[model samples]
Structures are given as structure tokens and as C-alpha cells.
Target: MHSFFVWYRVNRDEGDADMVIRGMMARLACRSGVGGRLIRKRDEPGLWMEIYADVADPARFEPLLRQAVDEFDVEMFIDGTRRTECFLAGDAIPAICA
Candidate 1:
């Protein structure tokens, strides 16, 4: 399995950040081979993150993500510094390293 982590700050001044996030979640939930959870940083009001687990190849999954973002117009609600990181579970965890 592959895992992807995305982090960003909401542009709350533009709209209801929570509502925009929920809309994004709803959109992504309909995609196959992808499952994710949305989270908020307790110490940072506008900061958020999403963790996705997918069995599909990253090549396949990345485009799906891009499409979803475009379809849902996510960029309008997020800050410019949004970031994403990806990993293969077995390769990324120190405890699993030989």
C-alpha cells in the first residue's frame, strides 16, 4: 500500500474553510482505490492535513487527485504553500527497515 500526506492552510477569508474541506472530502470519497481522512491541526487554526491510502500506482493516483482538485476547485480555498508527501509503508517506516 502507498500513503500520501497533504498539508495546507485554508484561505478562510475567501469562504467557509470547513465547508470547502467537507466538499472536497465528499468528492474524493467517490473515487475508487482511494480512501482518506481529513484532519485539522489543534494548534494551528487554518492548518489542515489529509492522509490517503491507495493500492493504485502513484502514477494513476496522482492524476485522480489532480482531477478531483480541479473538479472541486480546491485551489481557491487553500493557501499557496500547500504541500504533499508520499511513501510506501514498508519502505518509509524505520521499524520495518532491515
Candidate 2:
């Protein structure tokens, strides 16, 4: 199995990361052929990221990726990366991706 991670940031408050974002994000994942997505909140400071994973082609996730920030505005800024060169080599997805 292969996977990728999408990293981004949002305020650590509710106003910016609202319910609409959650619903939309859930919907996007459903549409993308992904089983689901995992959302992580930083313990120390301002950071929000979602890791979308599955066996589907990454290209199919592009629309959801673009809509995440462009339309929903759930994040302040998104710094994304594809785990092509280096990736975790174990069963712990959260430990490696987060």
C-alpha cells in the first residue's frame, strides 16, 4: 500500500476552523476514493493538518486538495508535500505522518 500526507495550518480556535469545513472535508474525502482522513491538532502551537490515505491514485485527490484551501478557507496557509523521496516504513501511520 502507498500513501501521502497533506500538511497545513489553521488557527487553534473554532471561528476559523468551523463546522462547514468539517462537513466539506468529509465530503471531499468521500468523493476522492479515500477511506477517510485523519486530522491532527498540534499540542504546542498553531498547526492543523490532514492526512489523506488509500490505494487510489493521488491524481484523483487533486480536486479535493485544491478545494480544501481555495474554497473552504479552513486553513491560514497550507504547506503540502508528497512523500515520494522519503516515507515511513512501518505500520504506524500517525507516528510517521504526524
10 residues in a row with least lDDT, candidate 2:
78-87
Q: What is candidate 1's lDDT per residue for 30-80, written digit by digit as tens?
A: 774577888888988688898887645788777777777788778888878
lDDT of 1: 0.77
Candidate 1 wrongly placed segments (more than 4 Å): 13-15, 91-98
lDDT of 2 by residue, 2-78 (tens): 46665555445655454655665677766776654546665833344455555456665665666754676644433
Local accuracy by lDDT, each model: 0.77, 0.53
Candidate with maximal TM-score: 1
Highest lDDT, which number? 1
